[model samples]
Target: MTESLHIVCPHCHTTNRVRADQLASDPSCGSCKQALFTGHPAALDEAAFDKHISRSQIPVLVDFWAPWCGPCRQMAPAYEQACAQLEPRVRLVKVDTEAVPNLGARYAIRSIPTLALFKNGREVARQAGAMGAADIVRWVQAHSA
Candidate 1:
Protein backbone atom coordinates (compact mmCIF):
# COMPACT_ATOMS: atom_id res chain seq x y z
CA MET A 1 0.00 0.00 0.00
CA THR A 2 1.15 3.53 -0.77
CA GLU A 3 1.54 6.10 1.91
CA SER A 4 -0.77 9.07 1.62
CA LEU A 5 -0.57 12.55 3.14
CA HIS A 6 -2.90 15.51 3.47
CA ILE A 7 -2.17 18.60 1.39
CA VAL A 8 -4.09 21.80 1.89
CA CYS A 9 -5.42 23.29 -1.29
CA PRO A 10 -3.92 26.66 -2.03
CA HIS A 11 -7.06 27.76 -3.82
CA CYS A 12 -9.97 26.57 -1.71
CA HIS A 13 -8.28 25.58 1.53
CA THR A 14 -9.62 22.05 1.18
CA THR A 15 -7.51 19.18 2.41
CA ASN A 16 -6.75 16.35 0.02
CA ARG A 17 -5.01 13.04 0.52
CA VAL A 18 -2.31 12.49 -2.04
CA ARG A 19 -0.30 9.34 -2.51
CA ALA A 20 3.40 9.87 -2.04
CA ASP A 21 4.33 8.63 -5.47
CA GLN A 22 1.92 10.76 -7.48
CA LEU A 23 3.22 14.12 -6.43
CA ALA A 24 5.45 14.80 -9.39
CA SER A 25 2.65 14.07 -11.82
CA ASP A 26 0.89 17.30 -10.78
CA PRO A 27 -1.75 16.02 -8.43
CA SER A 28 -4.98 17.99 -8.23
CA CYS A 29 -7.17 18.91 -5.32
CA GLY A 30 -10.09 16.49 -5.04
CA SER A 31 -12.53 19.30 -4.49
CA CYS A 32 -11.29 22.02 -6.86
CA LYS A 33 -9.37 19.68 -9.14
CA GLN A 34 -6.72 22.34 -9.53
CA ALA A 35 -3.17 21.38 -10.35
CA LEU A 36 -1.25 21.11 -7.11
CA PHE A 37 2.11 21.98 -8.61
CA THR A 38 2.23 23.30 -12.11
CA GLY A 39 6.03 23.17 -12.18
CA HIS A 40 6.01 26.76 -10.87
CA PRO A 41 5.56 28.28 -7.50
CA ALA A 42 2.07 29.09 -6.23
CA ALA A 43 1.71 32.79 -5.57
CA LEU A 44 0.65 32.94 -1.93
CA ASP A 45 -0.90 35.94 -0.26
CA GLU A 46 -0.91 36.82 3.43
CA ALA A 47 -3.97 34.87 4.64
CA ALA A 48 -3.32 31.87 2.42
CA PHE A 49 0.34 31.98 3.30
CA ASP A 50 -0.45 31.90 6.98
CA LYS A 51 -2.87 29.01 6.62
CA HIS A 52 -0.55 27.06 4.34
CA ILE A 53 2.52 27.55 6.45
CA SER A 54 0.71 26.85 9.65
CA ARG A 55 -1.51 23.90 8.73
CA SER A 56 0.19 22.09 5.89
CA GLN A 57 1.42 18.67 6.95
CA ILE A 58 4.16 18.74 4.35
CA PRO A 59 7.19 20.93 4.38
CA VAL A 60 6.72 24.24 2.54
CA LEU A 61 9.46 26.06 0.68
CA VAL A 62 8.66 29.65 -0.12
CA ASP A 63 10.40 31.82 -2.66
CA PHE A 64 10.19 35.47 -1.82
CA TRP A 65 10.55 37.53 -4.97
CA ALA A 66 9.58 40.73 -6.72
CA PRO A 67 8.57 41.14 -10.34
CA TRP A 68 11.00 43.92 -11.13
CA CYS A 69 13.96 42.17 -9.58
CA GLY A 70 16.31 40.82 -12.19
CA PRO A 71 17.68 38.07 -10.02
CA CYS A 72 14.24 36.96 -9.03
CA ARG A 73 13.25 36.54 -12.66
CA GLN A 74 16.48 34.74 -13.42
CA MET A 75 15.96 32.23 -10.62
CA ALA A 76 12.38 31.42 -11.56
CA PRO A 77 13.24 28.49 -13.83
CA ALA A 78 15.60 26.97 -11.30
CA TYR A 79 12.87 27.16 -8.69
CA GLU A 80 10.49 25.41 -11.05
CA GLN A 81 13.02 22.65 -11.65
CA ALA A 82 13.38 22.17 -7.94
CA CYS A 83 9.60 21.95 -7.62
CA ALA A 84 9.55 19.20 -10.22
CA GLN A 85 12.12 17.25 -8.25
CA LEU A 86 10.88 17.95 -4.75
CA GLU A 87 7.13 17.77 -5.18
CA PRO A 88 5.00 15.92 -2.58
CA ARG A 89 8.06 15.97 -0.33
CA VAL A 90 7.98 19.74 -0.35
CA ARG A 91 5.28 22.25 -1.20
CA LEU A 92 6.82 24.85 -3.49
CA VAL A 93 5.48 28.36 -3.04
CA LYS A 94 6.19 31.93 -4.04
CA VAL A 95 5.29 35.24 -2.52
CA ASP A 96 5.44 38.48 -4.43
CA THR A 97 7.33 40.86 -2.25
CA GLU A 98 5.74 43.84 -3.92
CA ALA A 99 2.25 42.58 -3.22
CA VAL A 100 2.93 41.49 0.35
CA PRO A 101 5.49 43.88 1.67
CA ASN A 102 4.65 42.98 5.23
CA LEU A 103 5.69 39.36 4.81
CA GLY A 104 9.02 40.35 3.28
CA ALA A 105 9.63 42.78 6.10
CA ARG A 106 8.54 40.21 8.66
CA TYR A 107 10.99 37.72 7.25
CA ALA A 108 13.64 40.45 7.05
CA ILE A 109 14.31 39.62 3.45
CA ARG A 110 17.47 41.37 2.38
CA SER A 111 17.64 39.95 -1.07
CA ILE A 112 15.55 38.62 -3.89
CA PRO A 113 15.01 34.90 -4.36
CA THR A 114 15.06 34.20 -0.68
CA LEU A 115 13.99 30.64 0.07
CA ALA A 116 12.49 29.74 3.41
CA LEU A 117 11.75 26.19 4.55
CA PHE A 118 8.82 25.62 6.86
CA LYS A 119 7.74 22.43 8.60
CA ASN A 120 5.13 21.78 11.28
CA GLY A 121 4.22 25.48 11.20
CA ARG A 122 7.68 26.85 11.90
CA GLU A 123 10.58 27.99 9.82
CA VAL A 124 13.56 25.71 10.14
CA ALA A 125 16.01 27.14 7.64
CA ARG A 126 16.41 29.78 5.00
CA GLN A 127 18.78 30.79 2.21
CA ALA A 128 19.26 33.81 -0.03
CA GLY A 129 20.07 33.94 -3.73
CA ALA A 130 19.47 31.55 -6.59
CA MET A 131 20.33 27.87 -6.47
CA GLY A 132 20.07 25.10 -9.03
CA ALA A 133 17.64 22.24 -8.79
CA ALA A 134 19.99 19.78 -7.09
CA ASP A 135 21.34 22.39 -4.74
CA ILE A 136 17.84 23.43 -3.75
CA VAL A 137 16.91 19.78 -3.17
CA ARG A 138 20.02 19.22 -1.06
CA TRP A 139 19.35 22.31 1.00
CA VAL A 140 15.80 21.24 1.79
CA GLN A 141 16.83 17.61 2.40
CA ALA A 142 19.50 18.67 4.84
CA HIS A 143 17.24 20.98 6.78
CA SER A 144 13.85 19.22 6.64
CA ALA A 145 12.46 15.72 7.31
Candidate 2:
Protein backbone atom coordinates (compact mmCIF):
# COMPACT_ATOMS: atom_id res chain seq x y z
CA MET A 1 0.00 0.00 0.00
CA THR A 2 1.17 3.52 -0.71
CA GLU A 3 1.95 5.59 2.28
CA SER A 4 -1.06 7.53 3.48
CA LEU A 5 -0.96 11.07 4.77
CA HIS A 6 -3.17 12.85 7.27
CA ILE A 7 -4.84 15.93 5.87
CA VAL A 8 -7.28 18.11 7.75
CA CYS A 9 -10.32 19.37 5.89
CA PRO A 10 -10.10 23.11 5.30
CA HIS A 11 -13.86 23.37 5.69
CA CYS A 12 -14.86 20.83 8.31
CA HIS A 13 -11.48 20.33 9.99
CA THR A 14 -11.96 16.57 9.91
CA THR A 15 -8.80 14.54 9.46
CA ASN A 16 -8.70 12.37 6.33
CA ARG A 17 -6.25 9.95 4.85
CA VAL A 18 -4.90 10.40 1.36
CA ARG A 19 -2.22 8.76 -0.67
CA ALA A 20 1.02 10.67 -0.47
CA ASP A 21 1.54 10.40 -4.19
CA GLN A 22 -1.98 11.48 -5.09
CA LEU A 23 -1.82 14.88 -3.49
CA ALA A 24 -2.10 16.74 -6.76
CA SER A 25 -5.23 14.86 -7.65
CA ASP A 26 -8.54 15.97 -6.19
CA PRO A 27 -8.83 14.45 -2.77
CA SER A 28 -12.01 14.63 -0.75
CA CYS A 29 -12.73 14.44 2.92
CA GLY A 30 -14.12 11.02 3.78
CA SER A 31 -16.65 12.43 6.20
CA CYS A 32 -17.42 15.88 4.83
CA LYS A 33 -17.03 14.93 1.14
CA GLN A 34 -15.47 18.30 0.39
CA ALA A 35 -12.52 18.66 -1.91
CA LEU A 36 -9.31 19.02 -0.01
CA PHE A 37 -8.00 21.80 -2.21
CA THR A 38 -10.50 23.67 -4.32
CA GLY A 39 -8.15 26.22 -5.83
CA HIS A 40 -9.71 28.85 -3.56
CA PRO A 41 -8.41 30.24 -0.31
CA ALA A 42 -9.81 28.81 2.89
CA ALA A 43 -11.63 31.39 4.98
CA LEU A 44 -10.11 30.99 8.40
CA ASP A 45 -11.19 32.52 11.66
CA GLU A 46 -8.84 32.89 14.62
CA ALA A 47 -9.78 29.53 16.14
CA ALA A 48 -9.61 27.76 12.79
CA PHE A 49 -6.33 29.41 11.96
CA ASP A 50 -4.88 28.34 15.29
CA LYS A 51 -6.03 24.77 14.75
CA HIS A 52 -4.89 24.48 11.15
CA ILE A 53 -1.55 26.21 11.59
CA SER A 54 -0.73 24.22 14.69
CA ARG A 55 -1.89 20.86 13.39
CA SER A 56 -1.40 20.76 9.63
CA GLN A 57 1.53 18.56 8.67
CA ILE A 58 2.04 20.27 5.36
CA PRO A 59 3.17 23.86 5.01
CA VAL A 60 0.44 26.49 5.11
CA LEU A 61 0.36 29.79 3.25
CA VAL A 62 -2.02 32.37 4.68
CA ASP A 63 -3.21 35.51 2.97
CA PHE A 64 -4.13 38.39 5.27
CA TRP A 65 -6.65 40.51 3.46
CA ALA A 66 -9.49 42.99 3.98
CA PRO A 67 -12.62 43.47 1.90
CA TRP A 68 -12.02 47.15 1.23
CA CYS A 69 -8.40 46.69 0.22
CA GLY A 70 -8.19 47.23 -3.52
CA PRO A 71 -4.89 45.42 -3.85
CA CYS A 72 -6.24 42.43 -2.00
CA ARG A 73 -9.33 42.30 -4.15
CA GLN A 74 -7.24 42.47 -7.28
CA MET A 75 -4.93 39.75 -6.09
CA ALA A 76 -7.61 37.29 -5.02
CA PRO A 77 -7.71 35.45 -8.31
CA ALA A 78 -3.96 35.18 -8.51
CA TYR A 79 -3.89 33.79 -4.99
CA GLU A 80 -6.52 31.25 -5.95
CA GLN A 81 -4.54 30.25 -8.99
CA ALA A 82 -1.49 29.72 -6.86
CA CYS A 83 -3.52 27.59 -4.51
CA ALA A 84 -4.60 25.42 -7.43
CA GLN A 85 -1.06 25.03 -8.66
CA LEU A 86 0.49 24.37 -5.27
CA GLU A 87 -2.14 21.95 -4.08
CA PRO A 88 -1.59 19.11 -1.63
CA ARG A 89 1.94 20.29 -0.98
CA VAL A 90 0.89 23.63 0.40
CA ARG A 91 -2.44 24.69 1.85
CA LEU A 92 -3.74 28.20 1.20
CA VAL A 93 -5.68 30.01 3.91
CA LYS A 94 -7.10 33.50 4.09
CA VAL A 95 -7.56 35.60 7.21
CA ASP A 96 -9.75 38.66 7.16
CA THR A 97 -7.67 41.18 9.03
CA GLU A 98 -10.59 43.54 9.42
CA ALA A 99 -12.73 40.95 11.14
CA VAL A 100 -9.92 39.42 13.16
CA PRO A 101 -7.73 42.22 14.38
CA ASN A 102 -6.10 39.98 16.94
CA LEU A 103 -4.67 37.70 14.27
CA GLY A 104 -3.51 40.65 12.24
CA ALA A 105 -1.90 42.19 15.29
CA ARG A 106 -0.36 38.91 16.38
CA TYR A 107 1.21 38.45 12.98
CA ALA A 108 2.10 42.13 12.80
CA ILE A 109 0.37 42.44 9.46
CA ARG A 110 0.67 46.03 8.32
CA SER A 111 -0.43 45.52 4.76
CA ILE A 112 -3.36 43.91 3.02
CA PRO A 113 -2.77 40.69 1.10
CA THR A 114 0.20 39.78 3.21
CA LEU A 115 1.20 36.18 2.54
CA ALA A 116 2.57 34.38 5.54
CA LEU A 117 4.15 30.91 5.42
CA PHE A 118 3.77 28.76 8.49
CA LYS A 119 5.24 25.42 9.49
CA ASN A 120 4.41 23.72 12.71
CA GLY A 121 2.48 26.80 13.83
CA ARG A 122 5.56 29.06 13.51
CA GLU A 123 5.94 31.61 10.77
CA VAL A 124 8.81 30.93 8.43
CA ALA A 125 8.38 33.93 6.14
CA ARG A 126 5.92 36.65 5.16
CA GLN A 127 5.45 38.89 2.13
CA ALA A 128 3.45 42.08 1.86
CA GLY A 129 1.35 43.44 -1.00
CA ALA A 130 -0.07 41.72 -4.04
CA MET A 131 1.82 39.47 -6.40
CA GLY A 132 1.06 37.74 -9.65
CA ALA A 133 0.14 34.07 -9.68
CA ALA A 134 3.54 33.06 -11.04
CA ASP A 135 5.33 35.11 -8.43
CA ILE A 136 3.13 33.66 -5.68
CA VAL A 137 3.80 30.12 -6.91
CA ARG A 138 7.52 30.81 -6.91
CA TRP A 139 7.32 32.10 -3.37
CA VAL A 140 5.45 29.00 -2.20
CA GLN A 141 7.91 26.73 -3.99
CA ALA A 142 10.84 28.59 -2.47
CA HIS A 143 9.51 28.30 1.09
CA SER A 144 7.92 24.85 0.93
CA ALA A 145 9.03 21.45 -0.39
Candidate 3:
Protein backbone atom coordinates (compact mmCIF):
# COMPACT_ATOMS: atom_id res chain seq x y z
CA MET A 1 0.00 0.00 0.00
CA THR A 2 1.13 3.53 -0.70
CA GLU A 3 1.63 5.92 2.17
CA SER A 4 -0.44 9.10 2.10
CA LEU A 5 0.09 12.61 3.36
CA HIS A 6 -2.25 15.40 4.38
CA ILE A 7 -1.91 18.71 2.63
CA VAL A 8 -3.81 21.88 3.41
CA CYS A 9 -5.07 23.89 0.50
CA PRO A 10 -3.48 27.31 0.20
CA HIS A 11 -6.54 28.67 -1.55
CA CYS A 12 -9.44 27.14 0.40
CA HIS A 13 -7.92 25.97 3.70
CA THR A 14 -9.30 22.53 3.05
CA THR A 15 -7.20 19.49 3.88
CA ASN A 16 -6.62 16.76 1.33
CA ARG A 17 -4.89 13.38 1.46
CA VAL A 18 -2.35 12.58 -1.19
CA ARG A 19 -0.18 9.58 -1.84
CA ALA A 20 3.38 10.17 -0.77
CA ASP A 21 4.73 8.83 -3.99
CA GLN A 22 2.56 11.09 -6.09
CA LEU A 23 3.48 14.36 -4.42
CA ALA A 24 5.70 15.47 -7.27
CA SER A 25 2.92 14.81 -9.79
CA ASP A 26 1.13 18.07 -8.96
CA PRO A 27 -1.81 17.41 -6.69
CA SER A 28 -5.03 19.42 -6.55
CA CYS A 29 -7.37 20.15 -3.68
CA GLY A 30 -10.45 17.98 -3.49
CA SER A 31 -12.77 20.79 -2.47
CA CYS A 32 -11.49 23.88 -4.22
CA LYS A 33 -9.91 21.98 -7.12
CA GLN A 34 -6.97 24.34 -6.94
CA ALA A 35 -3.39 23.23 -7.25
CA LEU A 36 -2.08 22.29 -3.84
CA PHE A 37 1.44 23.53 -4.33
CA THR A 38 1.88 26.85 -6.01
CA GLY A 39 5.48 27.96 -6.49
CA HIS A 40 4.86 31.00 -4.28
CA PRO A 41 4.33 31.55 -0.60
CA ALA A 42 0.72 31.47 0.50
CA ALA A 43 -0.36 34.60 2.33
CA LEU A 44 -2.01 33.39 5.49
CA ASP A 45 -4.35 35.14 7.87
CA GLU A 46 -5.15 33.95 11.41
CA ALA A 47 -7.68 31.23 10.75
CA ALA A 48 -5.92 29.93 7.68
CA PHE A 49 -2.64 29.98 9.52
CA ASP A 50 -4.08 27.87 12.32
CA LYS A 51 -5.55 25.37 9.91
CA HIS A 52 -2.39 25.03 7.90
CA ILE A 53 -0.14 24.78 10.92
CA SER A 54 -2.32 22.36 12.88
CA ARG A 55 -3.74 20.19 10.14
CA SER A 56 -0.97 19.80 7.63
CA GLN A 57 1.03 16.58 7.71
CA ILE A 58 3.89 18.19 5.83
CA PRO A 59 6.27 20.65 7.43
CA VAL A 60 5.40 24.35 7.14
CA LEU A 61 7.88 27.19 6.79
CA VAL A 62 6.49 30.58 7.67
CA ASP A 63 7.96 33.97 6.99
CA PHE A 64 6.85 36.24 9.78
CA TRP A 65 7.07 39.77 8.46
CA ALA A 66 5.48 43.19 8.48
CA PRO A 67 4.61 45.43 5.53
CA TRP A 68 6.65 48.37 6.81
CA CYS A 69 9.83 46.42 7.43
CA GLY A 70 12.51 47.01 4.85
CA PRO A 71 14.31 43.79 5.58
CA CYS A 72 11.10 41.87 5.22
CA ARG A 73 10.52 43.40 1.80
CA GLN A 74 14.09 42.69 0.82
CA MET A 75 13.72 39.03 1.74
CA ALA A 76 10.40 38.58 -0.06
CA PRO A 77 11.87 37.58 -3.41
CA ALA A 78 14.30 35.14 -1.82
CA TYR A 79 11.44 33.59 0.09
CA GLU A 80 9.50 33.28 -3.12
CA GLN A 81 12.44 31.61 -4.77
CA ALA A 82 12.76 29.25 -1.86
CA CYS A 83 9.12 28.38 -2.27
CA ALA A 84 9.70 27.49 -5.89
CA GLN A 85 12.48 25.13 -4.90
CA LEU A 86 10.87 23.72 -1.78
CA GLU A 87 7.24 23.27 -2.69
CA PRO A 88 5.58 19.83 -2.95
CA ARG A 89 8.00 18.89 -0.15
CA VAL A 90 7.34 21.79 2.20
CA ARG A 91 4.64 24.42 2.47
CA LEU A 92 5.85 28.01 2.47
CA VAL A 93 3.63 30.68 3.97
CA LYS A 94 3.71 34.35 4.88
CA VAL A 95 2.13 35.88 7.95
CA ASP A 96 2.00 39.65 7.94
CA THR A 97 2.77 40.85 11.46
CA GLU A 98 1.06 44.16 10.84
CA ALA A 99 -2.18 42.37 9.97
CA VAL A 100 -1.83 39.30 12.16
CA PRO A 101 -0.33 40.64 15.32
CA ASN A 102 -1.77 37.80 17.33
CA LEU A 103 0.22 35.21 15.42
CA GLY A 104 3.41 37.19 15.85
CA ALA A 105 2.77 37.52 19.57
CA ARG A 106 1.74 33.91 19.90
CA TYR A 107 4.99 32.83 18.29
CA ALA A 108 6.91 35.43 20.32
CA ILE A 109 8.37 36.90 17.20
CA ARG A 110 10.53 39.82 18.32
CA SER A 111 11.91 40.70 14.94
CA ILE A 112 10.78 40.99 11.35
CA PRO A 113 11.87 38.54 8.61
CA THR A 114 11.86 35.59 10.96
CA LEU A 115 11.59 32.10 9.57
CA ALA A 116 9.83 29.48 11.66
CA LEU A 117 9.76 25.84 10.68
CA PHE A 118 6.93 23.65 11.92
CA LYS A 119 6.61 19.92 11.79
CA ASN A 120 3.93 17.66 13.21
CA GLY A 121 1.97 20.73 14.36
CA ARG A 122 4.72 22.34 16.42
CA GLU A 123 7.62 24.66 15.75
CA VAL A 124 10.88 22.77 15.59
CA ALA A 125 13.25 25.51 14.54
CA ARG A 126 13.41 29.24 13.97
CA GLN A 127 15.75 31.74 12.34
CA ALA A 128 15.86 35.51 12.66
CA GLY A 129 16.85 38.06 10.02
CA ALA A 130 16.74 38.05 6.24
CA MET A 131 18.51 35.47 4.06
CA GLY A 132 19.03 34.72 0.41
CA ALA A 133 17.21 32.00 -1.52
CA ALA A 134 19.98 29.41 -1.22
CA ASP A 135 20.36 30.11 2.45
CA ILE A 136 16.63 29.85 3.02
CA VAL A 137 16.50 26.55 1.20
CA ARG A 138 19.51 25.22 3.05
CA TRP A 139 18.22 26.30 6.44
CA VAL A 140 14.81 24.74 5.88
CA GLN A 141 16.26 21.50 4.61
CA ALA A 142 18.63 21.24 7.53
CA HIS A 143 15.94 21.91 10.10
CA SER A 144 13.24 19.82 8.48
CA ALA A 145 15.57 16.89 8.15
Residue range 1-145, candidate 2, lDDT tens digits: 8888777799898777788888878899898898988878799899888888888878899999999999999999999899888877888999999999999999889888899999877899899989999999998888875
C-alpha RMSD by candidate, in order: 2.2, 1.5, 0.5
Clash pairs, model 3 backbone? none
The lDDT of model 1 is: 0.87
lDDT at residue 123 of model 2 (Cα atoms): 95
Judging by TM-score, tell me the better candidate of 2 and 3: 3
- Residue 99 alpha-carbon offset, candidate 2, angstroms: 1.3
Query: Candidate 1 regions off by >4 Å?
Result: 1-4, 19-27
lDDT of 1 by residue, 43-64 (tens): 8888889888987889999999
Model 3: lowest-lDDT 10 consecutive positions: 20-29
lDDT of 3 by residue, 12-109 (tens): 99999999999999999999999999899999999999999999999999999999999999999999999999998999999999999999999999
Ranking of all candidate structures by their lDDT, best first: 3, 2, 1
TM-score sort, best first: 3, 2, 1
* Model 2: colliding residue pairs: none
The lDDT per prediction is 0.87, 0.89, 0.96
Q: Give the TM-score of candidate 1.
A: 0.86
